[model samples]
Target: MSDKELTTKKYWEAYYKNSHVNKQHILTVCSYYSPIWEIFISNSEVSKSLIEIGGFPGRYLAYLANRYNIEPTCLDYNSDLTQIEGSFMEMDVQHYHIIKEDFIKFKPKLKYDYVMSNGFIEHFKNYDDILDLHVKYMSENGRLLVMIPNMKGYIQFYKYLVDYKNLKIHNLKCMKLKVFEDFAERHNLSILHLGYYGGFPLGIHQKINFLQKIIYKLHRLVFKYFANDKLKKYPSKYFSSAIVGVFEKQ
Candidate 1:
């Protein structure tokens, strides 16, 4: 409720007001193999009641509606993105519901069978606290899906070369896994699976082709070694470009 939380309203409004990355790329990656595909489709039966935190423009939610036959209302602090679909409500995530407002001002009263946030929390300086927010809303036996910038992704290296705003952690932190796991445990959520992409093991994204079928297969051979038992055993903050956790609330 202080100035710190208040900034989210303006920050996110600017984000949603701007043009996004090419929608085609989103459809190609997310529509195909990302957790977005798995979470959206697997829980399609409960689509009508789903509530997406940080839902922007309803792109992924719309994917669920179109591809998985689920109707989901998206929520964000921005009013503009909610215009076309009418499936949005303006509410801040940290301090919502103070004066009979939306779910953002206070703890969520509605329990969703599935709660998801993708590429949203990583922007926070304190991602640990950000994730705890989601865990608070998770229904018993519900699933929480999160996709952040992968620390080990091919694109991450490029960020160092070309952009100044790349995730600073790789440049700063020793480990990020413990941070993620701690947040999950504090709320009694268990992570089921985690993956790194471009198809895995060998650097699948290295090939200039980007669509070379052979490289994808070779990367399959690569995934097993890179994400070996030892590394995978450690907290997700220890490795990978981004992480996805399928959490079941206890």
Candidate 2:
């Protein structure tokens, strides 16, 4: 499956139907980005408004609400979202709101202090349009946080060579840091930070074969036993599985 096919609602719905992993908890998402969020939120004050695009379940936003006291909002088109065990409606955090609509066409009367998306941009060939929409909702000096699979990184190289069959189902674009730089230039966004970090490996998804599953477990064990905590804070295209960028509107 190409990234195009993988991003379709049909594929994701089917994928979600079979997966029960991190579906119900904000802890997983918050813990994964704790280092990145620490840096991103360091100089900023709490209570800043934030909106997450396509952040279904809204667990991370809920976590932010609890951790930073920031007002949280999420935009998604999942009308049946309440059926999910961990959807936004289930989170206990206060001041968390949901806008159930197509994110591309969503327009709010009030702008946000921060805009975020994880694993979102790589889905569409027209990433510019989607990114521009995120920017349009940001207040002046507002920040944008985007996280995606690192196509140009060493992890991808390993996957291509070792788990080539499993990798094909992901349908991720070969997006490099430069692609984001281009978007920043075109949109009057300044690159505050850009780097790679550890993330969920490809083979853990439900569609992978048994051999890929073994490889995934082995990769997790290696990271658990041998990875350096400090070094993991620094982004390396050659080593990190995920790329993260923090941008500020100029």
Candidate 3:
């Protein structure tokens, strides 16, 4: 299938249905070690409202709601979001909403204080269209937080070695910080923070064979023992796990 077809609602629905649900909470994912968390905490204030675009099985959204006591909303094309809703409840997040609609057609009744998407926009061919939707739902001076896999670096090389098909689904060009900076400039959004984040992450987002699994494990060991702290402090575009941007509408 073409990249366009791969990013369609039908494709995503099927992908989510077939994939196992991640019951792991965001905190357990070592989020504090990454710059993404730092940017989030530094830019966010308590009691602000946030809407997560295309955030199905909203673990990250739940994390934000629980951590900051923020009202949260999750919007996605996926029909069954009971898992995500349950997560919110389990986390004791009282004020949260889940909208089962395509983000392209979603019209919010009120703009949110923050609009966010985790690994969402890179699936699209048109980065501006996806970003415009995020901007459309934000209140004036609201912040937009976007995080995408750093697929242009060694991660891309690793994916090419073991998960080329999965890599193809992502728009590698969108992973660049320049793309976001250009978008922010055109849209009159001030860049609060923009850079790569995290240590070398072991991306198991796709299925791999036995040998590939062993290699992945070895890589995880290497990163954990030697590279984690250094990379976390100075996340380079060549090896950092994600590219993150925090922008405020100006």
Candidate 4:
């Protein structure tokens, strides 16, 4: 199936319908243990106006709003964004806007200081088109942060074992840091940072069978006891769970 078909509104609707807003899950993502925190800390001087494309549940966006006191806007195609609004309210994020519209067709009057997407762009075969949308809505010198799950090596192996269907939607070719580097050079955007992030015990955010769960438990125990610190210190393309890029429109 094509990328478009794989990531249809119906698909996302079904996804959100089954997903509940877990405050603990959101807190964990914002915590220091997560590599996402590293990105936030590194870019501490980022702007006050931000928008997140495909930001459902608004976990990262809400965290950014709370942490940095930035105004946040969430643009998503799904109508289920009411749940995200509810989540924001629960998080005590009082000031935020949720736009229910296809990002490709979205035309905002005001540009954002930061354009961000987490696990968003890989859903498209023509990812440059998505990247262009990010740049399009960004103000001059604004930062664009794009993050994707690293499905290139052992992480891919684990994803295939646990969630093959979910794995099929992502464009694995675009997961490389070189792709972002080349794109930044071509688009005249300065690459502030681009690299693989996080390490070991892949984030298998999908349902698994009993045997698979037991195996994953064992895997976690082994990593916790022996390799957690070492793996985290040495996040490579093959071992890291995510690939992140921060670029400035110059």
The alpha-carbon lDDT assigned to residue 161 of candidate 4 equals 80
Model 3 lDDT per residue over 19-75, tens place = 333445556753563455556554445468889898877777877777777888998
Q: How would you encode candidate 4's per-residue C-alpha lDDT over 127-191 as one tens digit per residue?
A: 87777778888787788888887898876887788767878988897889888888898789987
What lDDT is obtained when candidate 1 is compared to the true structure? 0.51
The number of clashing residue pairs in model 2 is 2
Q: Which stretches of candidate 4 lie over 4 Å from their true place?
A: 1-5, 32-47, 205-215
Ranking by TM-score: 3, 4, 2, 1
Residue 120, candidate 4: Cα error in Å is 0.6
Clashing pairs in 3: none
Q: Is candidate 3 or candidate 4 better by TM-score?
A: 3
Better of 2 and 3 by lDDT: 3
RMSD list, candidates in order:
8.8, 3.8, 2.8, 2.9
Model 2 Cα lDDT, one tens digit per residue, 112-216:
888899877767766766667777888888888998776665566767745665466453553677777888998988888887777435444435667766777
Backbone clash count, each prediction separately: 17, 2, 0, 0
TM-score of each: 0.61, 0.79, 0.87, 0.87
Q: Can you give the lDDT of residue 103 in candidate 4?
A: 81
Q: What TM-score does candidate 4 reach?
A: 0.87
lDDT of 2 at 146: 90
Error of 2 at 7 (Å): 1.9
| Alpha carbon lDDT of each predicted model | 0.51, 0.68, 0.78, 0.77
